[model samples]
Target: MTALLNELHAHYNGAKLDPSSITRHLEDNLLSPESVLKIVVASDSGGEVVGLLAFTFLNSLVDPAPEKRLQCMIKELFVKESFRSAGTGRDLMNWVIAHAKTAGCARMDWHVKATNEAGIRFYRSFGAAPVADRASFRLMLR
Candidate 1:
């Protein structure tokens, strides 16, 4: 998992080791299932993991403010560029969709940069929307 995280971080940031970084944020977030979903990957060629996808589940009340919570949000997700356009992403999405359905998520949400045309097109091919309107602020929970 650590190695896989490193790889994903490297691709996302274009750097080897980034501090105060999303990689740290993700690793710390993974301490509890309440925070994020760490997807499992299978690989050959000596069983090296080459990708990762991290998502956060947020709960909300719809009517009467129920004791339970409504579902949503895939905070972070990625597949290594080398393995892209392969079945790996499909397999990963299959798992995520199933999990989201089981979790009763009203909708699954994620975002890709506007500059990422290939990613946007690939997502569109899956019948998923590529754009989002958001205000992202990092919380200082420490």
Candidate 2:
């Protein structure tokens, strides 16, 4: 877990992640371990942290769903710069999807930056379709 956090911190150039926040979160939540999926390293070498994926789980509202009856949010993803095109991200997404399937999830969702053309393309390659009718906004607490 610590290894995964460090990898994402390096990839985002100190954005998207705050190490102290993760530390505090682990202290609070790792005890019971809820539905949230935090950053996790994908490593080849025993101690090497290459990339990570962060996600969350949600119960599906729809009735008569065939799968886990839950949904997943792909919150954050990152591959080491040298490993970007090496299929690490794809593998990570695959793992997430498999996990959702095991958890009886019916759907998965996540957002990407509109300006991230490469990211969009990559996500599309993984069968992520764009929702043209919806809009999203966020409010900063501070």
Candidate 3:
């Protein structure tokens, strides 16, 4: 799990992943239910971890609808390069969709890098579209 996470983080940030930091963060968030949920997909042949999906459920303060207050946001999704075309990503996403629905989430949302054409295509395959009116901004604390 650490290795897979390292690969995913490095691919985007080009930073070395600290196993202890990752483990600690997961433990802290997971200990509090609904903070973050992580799911891993393993290869059937050798039980090697091939993909991972992490998402969080949040309640929008401004959304007045009771049943629609909760929204699921995918924090990260990644599949091993060798497993990209093997439906691993699809399976992980399908599971998250069902899980969110079952939990009464109003919607599921995520962002993909504009330069990641393959990621964009994969999300679009499931009817996901970019929100043209919105732009993503980030601030680095560290």
Candidate 4:
């Protein structure tokens, strides 16, 4: 998991990552029954984790119904570079889709970096279409 996180960090930020904080966060939330976060991993024949998908349930703010509508947000989806093009990513995504269905999620959402052409193509193969005219913004809290 740490290796995968490091790969993700390198791909996105190109900076050193503090594994301690990530490990602490995972430890606190991963096994907690009350926690909304969940992680699904794909392992090789040697039982080595090669891919992972992390997701969480969130209340949809766009729904106007009285009952709260839950949606799944994919926080991270990654497969080791060596494992790419071998159906590992597809398996991980299918697992997440099944899990989301079981969790009663009305929808699932995730963000892909604009520079990641292969990632976009992978998602499109899954019948996912990008939201038109929608932009993502983030405010870093120090």
Candidate 5:
């Protein structure tokens, strides 16, 4: 799992991930029934993990409708380079989307870097569109 995270970080040109932090997060989520985090992994016949998708279930008071109150945000979706185009990623995505719908989520959302043309293409093929009205922002606590 840590190796897969490292590959995801590489794809983002981001900082190295700390295995201990990852372990802590998994442990916390696993032990908490109220945890919103859900991570799904796909393994090969030989039991090697080839793809992963992580997402969070969210609720917003802004959506007055009960069915629209719940939403899902995909934090990451990655397939091993060797597994690309083998349907692993699509299978993972389909599984997550179905799971979200079953969980009463109104919609599923994710972000793709502007420079990641391939990523954009994959998402477009999956029927995702850009939200032109919103811009993403973040602040580092440290």
Candidate 6:
């Protein structure tokens, strides 16, 4: 959601997020039958979205288990600042975990910013451990 994008921009040293491009991307993915992207939103009683989680299923070459060829990658998880510590995040993560199990995912993965101590602590409470041997890199191509 736009709120999450704005928060991410602020957290990541002022990276810009173009709303139009994001809208186009989301629409394309949501309309494509083969797209693996999945999204979930938590809303208030009045139907205003307060949190959002976006994830996708991916094939892992290193995972050889037949039943677990697929893995779930959490692309983004965000809850409104006002809703933090109110169990909205826990509920969203629980849903995603259940969804992954139902989808036969071998594992679920996500990254937390090093500076995000609260986020790191939250994930750790779920018994999620960091893969110390691996590092993430990205090359943005315009």
Backbone atom clashes (below 3 Å) for every candidate: 0, 2, 0, 0, 0, 0
- Tens-place lDDT digits, model 4, residues 29-127: 665777776889898998878999988888877895534488889988989889999999999999898888887777789999888999999999988
List pairs with backbone clashes in candidate 2.
Answer: 68-104, 68-105
Which of the predicted structures, 1 or 5, would earn the higher TM-score when compared with the native? Answer: 5
List the candidates ranked by lDDT, beginning with the highest.
Answer: 5, 4, 6, 3, 2, 1
Which segments of model 5 are wrong by more than 4 Å?
13-35
lDDT (Cα) of model 2:
0.76
- Over 8-114, each residue of candidate 3 has an lDDT whose tens digit, in order, gives 87887888678888777666764456565655455547877889888888998899798889999998888987788889899999999999899999988888889
lDDT of the structure predicted as candidate 4: 0.84
Q: RMSDs, each prediction?
A: 4.6, 3.4, 2.4, 2.7, 2.5, 2.7
lDDT of 6 by residue, 1-142 (tens): 6555556556566675677765666567653677776789898887767888889989988877879799999998988788889999999999999999998998999988878899999999988988999888889998
Candidate 1 lDDT over residue span 1-142, tens digit each: 5566667768777766654464576556765556556555645467766555566567765533433464556655566667777777777777877887787666677767778898778678778874456644557999
Report the CA-based lDDT of candidate 1 relative to the real structure: 0.65
Range of the 10 consecutive residues with the lowest summed lDDT in candidate 3 = 35-44
Candidate 1 stretches with Cα past 4 Å from truth are: 18-29, 32-37, 61-69, 130-142
Candidate 3 or 4, higher TM-score?
3
- As for model 5, its CA RMSD to the true structure in angstroms is 2.5
**Cα-based TM-score, every candidate:** 0.69, 0.75, 0.84, 0.82, 0.83, 0.81
Per-residue accuracy of model 5 over 1-142 as CA lDDT, tens digit each: 6667667777777676777876675677633677766789998898887899988988876986998989899988999889998999999999998998999999888988888898898889879998999888989999
lDDT of each: 0.65, 0.76, 0.82, 0.84, 0.84, 0.83
Error of 4 at 74 (Å): 0.6
**Which residue pairs collide, candidate 6?**
none
Q: Write the per-residue lDDT of candidate 2 for residues 8-93, one digit (tens) a residue.
A: 66656765567778777667774336645655558866656677787887776665565656788888888777778899998998
